[model samples]
Target: MAASRTIEDIINSDTDNEGDFEGFSSESDISVCSDLSDNDSESESEVDQPRNDEWTKRFTPITVNDFTCESGTKLPDSFDVNSASPLDYFWLLFSMELFVEIARNTNRYAKWRMDQTGTVDPYWTETTPNEIRAFIGMEIIMGINQLPDTMMYWSKNPLIGNAGIQDIMTANRYQKVRQYFHVSDREKEPARGHRDYDRLYKVRPILDHVTVSFLLNYNVGRELAVDEAMIRYSGKLSFRQYMPAKPIKRGIKVWMACDSNSSYLSRFQVYLGRSAVGVEHGLGFNVVSGLTNNIHGTYRHVYFDNFFTSIPLLEHLYENGLYGCGTVRVNRRGFPTELKKPKEIKNRGESMVMQKGDSNLIATVWKDKRLVHHLSTLNQPDDIQPAQRRVGPTVLQLQQPASVKSYNKYMGGVDQHDQLRMNYTVGRNSKKWWRYLFWFLVNCSIVNAFIMYKETSKRPRNKKRYTHIDFRIELAQGLISGYTGRKRKASEIDCIPLVDSQNVSGHINGKLSGPKGRCRYHLKTLGVRRETVYGCTVCRVHLCRDGCHARFHNL
Candidate 1:
């Protein structure tokens, strides 16, 4: 008798209201499913599902169905990476538009914060895109060389001081930016209990823009994987999820899809689960369908784990010309009962296969160390492949179905993505829950950029290759250099490298070969740091020549 609420509605409301969970939507490029029923009473798919007795008559022995989709790298054919900088690769995902939007919203929020507290801070000012880049550079370096406290990056103590990060901005400046960093306007957020009050409204703008960038910059491969990832937040929040089995026990749960070959994050959506789903075809079905909506009709095969695999989901994928394969649970409504615990499949490496009537849907039962059940729409029923199982120093061949083979191969993409992201993460302590997601996005940007850099460049420079740390360092240097170039352009010295990379050796104490300006390397007689011109024709700096130029270069 009550009106059926949608997935968004269920998430927005903290309490479980009685309604059929249906119709879903995202920004653009994602299609919504309409009026999907929650129970057999109204669900057409469940109503038509074959019973155990019916499955007995419809089930047939293994049969081959020759079907496969063309899979390849998706990229802009004309785009060249030969001369591209590391920053260029990073900018592919974190663009000028995104930066500008973030800066605008940050400034807006700063004003709101001040207005809400009715106080003004003396040191805070509107942040510029260049400053934001430098802030990000600082964050990147911080990830690479973690200290106990953020302020330690600019610590005066010898044990913790980092000149590389300090040169970008003063510690005070960096902390100020972090204090007010934001992405969406608070003034416009809908009031509680309103129809449009979204829990994720604060960071929705950032997600929308970055997701568009991610989708447009890379092409989807043939094998796509969907899985859940934790964002590592133990803070108090309504939707924060706790998975005891996950390495990260508590955080926001996000559903993600990644390209199987390269672990490229294709799409992601945050899970808003404050309460349980009171409907069939619950969370997993909606998540898979929404995440894969962009790839429908292209014959792409999607692989997931048992949580998302179901009879209705497989049928939905098959009907849309997409293929689905995943480890399945025997207890799901339409699963054949005979194969639930078949005693004959006791030997390791043995597998049983059956077709669902005459359709492309095939169910496989493989016996390894344990019995595994799989359902697939694209793999042939009888296509068995060889697998190697290790027993001490000896290895033996094990029989495997093609669907099992593919699942084993592609199911790790999401995990791989998480692993790569966890390394050198830009995560830090934050009072705002959204900031954790922000840092996660930053880590995603780094991982995605590095992947593109690895795939596209013959070598970034110097006939040399870059490791992950190398990429992060270079990216930080580029942002700092780029920012410095913007600040001063009055003379021959366009920019100078960070102190650690500078040619501090041998170049110092050289004869003054260039025009004269004040010396740059010495303290003034009054103990003040010199701002006098330190001109060097050789170094290309427009500084006034002082007698100390010789002494300055040596130090």
Candidate 2:
């Protein structure tokens, strides 16, 4: 006979000596079921089992259920509806959808949302409602704010969700939204009225895109802002599709002006063309005209670039009680007659020339029986003392080495031929040259503007000294270093040679070296060649040499 054993003892013995039983030769005696039939057998098994008294005492049953405190409170069955406003729900949906999309693409938001909510709901399921969805979409696209829950909820009531929500939430969504908002109305208006609508409507989209584009310039603390925007049309059409035709290709360019400190886009314009100057197209004129009709009152300064800074345009702006500050083509109508001719100034050193004070360059076009030229009606009667001098430098600065390096891929270096050859090529194809040059200038202007904006956006308490020189140096460094893998070295060549009252000086350094030495570099580098060559007083093309026969000039 054998000792009686309990179930616990049997289990413990089996576990403790599992290897010992491997050699149990008597199968009949080791019948597990047969051995457990009697109370005595079970008791004997319990007596023989191994035990850890401390472990056995410490092991207590753990019953886990929905946790409840002594106060009998428990987690609510649903989300905190009272805590979340309509806006909150809207924003949540919007953000969640965005998160879902990002999650699907990169799997980042998926894990985060799962960890946060312990459930996964498809974005489509959450963003199906109009009022809830629109707010959410806007929140995700724009941002959310803190407010009374009631107000936020009410405001989100009108929101809508659609397949386009994804597109609407993109940084570029404003333009598309604006386009969607206006395109149908524009198509319905009379041709003339539609033209006007097109112009005024351009403002918002431009502002939206520009605000986002120049975010970095404003140091907005996010990369979400857009700085440069372009729109190109594509559809089934021949190469010669005309305006207003179906499948017509169209493009728009926008430039923004912002509040100095706030970095908010305060003003902007949409130019319809391949280049800024293309704003001269009928569509551009209509847009400008429309914008003019819409402005409620006067403006202190109408800042723009050379493309839109025409005499007629300035005069029109002035009629609206706005002053203007923008780059103007040297040949633009209304340039002071004292300015040098484009040909004379081409590839030549800078020099001031005197002309009849009353003579102004004006735009002229001939009709069947009459000749017409664009003129500035705002020019003060020759009698009026000239208004306060234009505040900034009149001359366009050259690109810095850094800017050149960064932008060289687009600028294409200078032609190897001499300045005369270069001028001839540009002059022969003035339209093409002007178009390319204007775009290049636009890019440079944007960079300059961004630098100015960023410098101005610093915390007032922790501001740093910033200057045009600093910007130039930084840009040059970026361009040179980025493009050629070389940097602008410190040297006398980097310095602007000074001149006397006559604007003449001895050649301090025999030949410019580094980037300045390269002819192509001159065309691309900022504030270097132009500042040097055009500003030089000693150069033969600039000030009259002692023995030269050219007409002497004065301010």
If scored against the real structure, what TM-score would every candidate get? 0.75, 0.26
Give the winner by lDDT. Answer: 1
Which ten residues in a row are the worst by lDDT in model 1?
21-30
Give candidate 1's error at residue 346 in angstroms. Answer: 2.0
**lDDT tens string, model 2, 241-317?**
23443222433344334332223332344444344454453342344444333221223223333445565664454
| Candidate 2 error regions (>4 Å) | 1-228, 232-263, 267-299, 330-555
Q: Against the unseen true structure, what C-alpha lDDT does each candidate score? A: 0.73, 0.29
> In model 2, what is the error at residue 275, expressed in angstroms?
17
lDDT score for residue 378 of model 2: 20
Error of 1 at 512 (Å): 27
What would the TM-score be for candidate 1 when compared with the true structure?
A: 0.75
lDDT of 2: 0.29
